[model samples]
Target: MPYYMFQWKYKNEAVKALVQTPQDRAAELRKVVQAFGGRLHEFFFAFGDYDGVSIVEFPNNERCAACATTLTGAGANDLFRTTVLLTGDEAKAALAMANATNPDYAPPTGYTHHS
Candidate 1:
């Protein structure tokens, strides 16, 4: 299973709803992830570009995308946006593969490599 970090920012409407009626959102989101054959490792509210973030593990990218699409499709678009995250190891492997390929390319106009 691959892990993902899901981040979101609440809309004014959602903030108003929460202020009027606080709810156990973690439990709610856990159920959604479980339904998609995924596990919700953690969920937290934060202060920054995003209002909340969640760490989850799914079988594959398709399953992860399905979860995002379903949530966003079901009225979340007005409430928040989601992002998929990758692990450091995965990123390192990708970099290694890119280096192994030794791709040949020239820089844009007015730029030159000095090596």
Candidate 2:
């Protein structure tokens, strides 16, 4: 499974609706995720550009994209974005792979490689 970080901001209508009737949105999303053979690891509210964030694992990129697209198109969100997440071990492996095969290219002009 591939992990993804989903962040979203609520539209005014959605905010109003939640204020009037609060509920655990993660529980709602878990149904959708499970339907797609996915798992919702963590879900919580935040206080920044996005109102909430969730860490989820889906079978693949296609399913993740479809889920994100459907959610964003639901009209309940003002902002929505999904970011692919990599584990520490995965990051280390990527670094080693890159170190083994880095592209050699010349800089455009007056450039020096910075350590």
Candidate 3:
């Protein structure tokens, strides 16, 4: 499964609705994501630019996209930014590959000049 980190900022109307029905919101989201074959891991209220952040797991990117699209279609119009998280091992592998770059590289112009 792939893990996703989503930060969401609710629209004014959705915020008002959520304020009036806070308890059911999580349950509703869980049900919807489950229907799309994704699992909602964490949902938290925040005190910054975004209203909440949710961590989710899905079989693939398509299922994750479906969940995001569903949220938008429900008239909530919540603005969301999602990032797919890679495991630590994957990150390490990528870093190692990147460090295997050309060893004969010469410094570019002005490299010897100090600011």
Candidate 4:
């Protein structure tokens, strides 16, 4: 299973709804993730650009995409924007591959220094 981080900012309506009906959103979130054969590791509310974040593990990207699509399609799209995150190990592997390739490019001869 691959891990993912989902970050979101709540819309005004969502905030209002939460105020009106305070609930254990983590439980609801867990159910959603479980329905897709995934596990919700952590869910948290924060003070920042994003209203909340969730760490989850799913079978693959397609399952993750399905979860996001289902949430967004079912009116959540109006209430939040979601971002997918990658792990440090995944990034490191990508960097290693890039370094192995060592792509190089030449600047155009007409290019001039601005600084």
Candidate 5:
């Protein structure tokens, strides 16, 4: 499974709706995520740049994208973004792969540069 980090800011209409009738948004999100074969690990209400953030896991990128886009299709949020996340071990493995394949890759040195 692949993990994703999402941050979102609600539009004024969305804020009004939630305030008018506060509900468990996480539970609602879980329903949608489960339909897409994904799981919500954490959802938090935050301050500053983003109003909220969440971590989710899906079988793959396609499923993750589908779920995320569908959830935001209602025009409730003003700003929304989803980003892929890698575990420490996975990052280490990527570094090792880059090292192993370094020999086959070369940078262009045709242009002159002034120091």
Candidate 6:
């Protein structure tokens, strides 16, 4: 499964709704994620440009996107962005295989040939 970081900012109307009732949105969001084959690992309400940040895990990017769409439809604010996250082990594996020293490989522009 892949992890994703979701950031959302509330529209004025959405803010009004939350201001009227500030509790349980995090819990509600977890339910939404679960419904879409994703799991909400962490959620935080912020005091900055974005209203909240959530870390979610899904079997694939499609499922992650579905979760985001569902949140939007459930009256979350607009302009949502999702960033895919690689676990430490996944990153390490990629790093190890990045350049396996294939003699026939040609480096892309500005990249130095590996010795």
In terms of lDDT, the poorest run of 10 residues in model 3 is: 70-79
True-vs-predicted CA distance for residue 61, candidate 1, Å: 1.5
C-alpha positional error of residue 57 in candidate 1 after TM-score superposition, expressed in Å: 1.5
Model 4: weakest 10-residue lDDT segment is 76-85
Off by over 4 Å in 3: 100-115
Q: What is the lDDT of residue 70 in candidate 4?
A: 77
Q: Provide the lDDT at 11 for model 2.
A: 97
What is candidate 6's lDDT per residue for 1-115, written digit by digit as tens? 8999999998898888878977787798898888888888999989888888989899898888788887777765866889999999999888777757545765687987668
Candidate 4 error regions (>4 Å)? 77-84, 105-115
| Top candidate by TM-score | 2
Model 1 clash pairs are none
Tell me the TM-score of each prediction against the true structure: 0.80, 0.90, 0.78, 0.77, 0.87, 0.81
Better of 1 and 2 by lDDT: 2
Candidate lDDT (C-alpha), each: 0.82, 0.91, 0.83, 0.81, 0.90, 0.85
Compared with the true structure, model 3 gives a TM-score of: 0.78
Clashes of each: 0, 0, 0, 0, 0, 0
Cα displacement (angstroms), candidate 5, residue 35, comes to: 0.6
Report per-prediction Cα RMSD to one decimal.
Answer: 2.9, 2.0, 3.6, 3.2, 2.8, 3.9
What's model 1's TM-score? 0.80
Instruction: Pick the winner on lDDT between candidates 2 and 3.
Output: 2
lDDT of each residue in 1-115, candidate 1, tens digit only: 8888887777788878888999998998898899899999999999988788899999988888888787776664354555567689998998898899878866798986699
**Model 5: lDDT to the true structure:** 0.90
| Predicted candidate 3 versus true structure: per-residue lDDT over 1-115, tens digit per residue | 9899878888998888778876666777789889989999988888898888888899999999988888877766557888999899989988897788746767897678668
Stretches of candidate 5 above 4 Å error?
A: 103-115
User: Tens digits of per-residue lDDT for model 4 on 51-108?
Assistant: 8888999998898888877776666434454456668998899889998988786689
